[model samples]
Target: MDRSSGGRDRILRPVIRQFDLKDLPAIVEIDREVGGGYSPELFMTFHEYHPQTMLVAEAAGGVVGIVIGFKHTPLEGRIFWLAVKPAHQGRGIGRSLLSAILRIFSRLGAVSATLEVRIGNRRAQSLYASMGFVVDNVIPSYYSDGEAALIMRKIL
Candidate 1:
């Protein structure tokens, strides 16, 4: 369901809004569902570091996806921690979240946006590529599991 449209199928309706402390559990669930669980410490770290730019997508009475991001003043760029629940994959949620983020970056006058994705996450790579991001480099051992990360960037 599209919250913007007030449709009836809202059973898995999509809503996009700023992050709140109350939304942490849903965020954590999405993180874990995506095989990228985040600790309370890390979750707090995310909120403390970037409150204004973060967004959550709620569907079926739970948080189905999340995008935690913020602008880096020195570099005038934005980076994010984005994930969606496995069951909710293939929907336009990720794109909506990314679009929201880019709007925030544009508002901040960021010249570019950057993010890192595990090399094996082709779906994510495809999403970024479709959104106009280019592969910038590979960062070795970027994950605790020793997975390398594909660094991508979008020049606004």
Candidate 2:
């Protein structure tokens, strides 16, 4: 897939795998770059609670994408966070992460999956919509910056 690490020219392919402690820093960095700004504690909590559900995409021996999700019940799941390195965006990393998480939810017998995206993030909203996630509700002031969020859900 032409994944190059540190300017080296080599054919690289990333595998979607479970998150590891070493991937934490990369996850935080990607979140900041994407303006997610979620606290480290939250990420740690997600990892500690459902380590298997958290996934990362590694190519050229570096973490480039991540998905943090939690299974709320046998029938419900929530995608808490997803981010891909800015340089890796538009390369299907985000889609891959989402698909991986959804696959896990299905295997775990989750009937539905839910998430919230900023109201103005048309790109993300479009991606979610394309994945069959319909807007289920609106959350006023859902973000710390007072940006409303659109709650989207997909029946898995």
Candidate 3:
């Protein structure tokens, strides 16, 4: 998606595509930069079991964003993680990745999609809300750091 604000200064259009094994390093780096702290092994596991739901956003010839999700049950999909390189954030890459994953989930026959967001992350909450996800519940001490999480869901 092209996130340029106006004419005469076009931004690089991000191309959303399936995750490639070669994108592992870049994806890990983006997650680290975004303070996600997710292990590379987690991504590899998702790739192994749910390759269709793992996607990356490429811009300027580099991987700038990624989303990992899966249809955990016949009627539900779960979004495990999403991150955009700090330098590439606020330009729609994260949103594009999210939209792509949600579409994949719908195509995979999910009736609903769900995700968890840190309570303190209002930005993420807002984005998810804008994408039709509503807060379904809250999990106390959900994170290793003792932070609570908001469970959000959307009907696919």
- Identify the candidate with maximal TM-score: 3
The lDDT for every candidate, in the order shown, is 0.80, 0.85, 0.90
Q: What are the clashing pairs of model 1?
A: none
TM-score, per-candidate, Cα-based: 0.84, 0.87, 0.92
Q: Write the per-residue lDDT of candidate 1 for residues 46-126, one digit (tens) a residue.
A: 788777678888776777888887777744566668887877766777888888888888887788899999999898999
Model 3: per-residue Cα lDDT over 70-118, one tens digit each = 8889999999999988887676777899999999898889999999999
Query: Model 2: per-residue lDDT, tens digit, 27-84?
Result: 8898898888788888888889998789999875689888989888879889988887
Cα deviation of 96 in candidate 1 (Å)? 0.5
Off by over 4 Å in 1: 1-13
> How many pairs collide in each candidate, listed in order?
0, 0, 0
User: Of the pair 1 and 3, which is ahead by lDDT?
Assistant: 3
In model 1, what is the error at residue 90, expressed in angstroms? 0.4
Q: Compared to the true structure, candidate 1 yields what TM-score? A: 0.84
> What is the TM-score of candidate 3?
0.92
Greater-TM-score candidate between 1 and 3: 3
Q: Which 10 residues in a row give candidate 2 its minimum summed lDDT?
A: 3-12
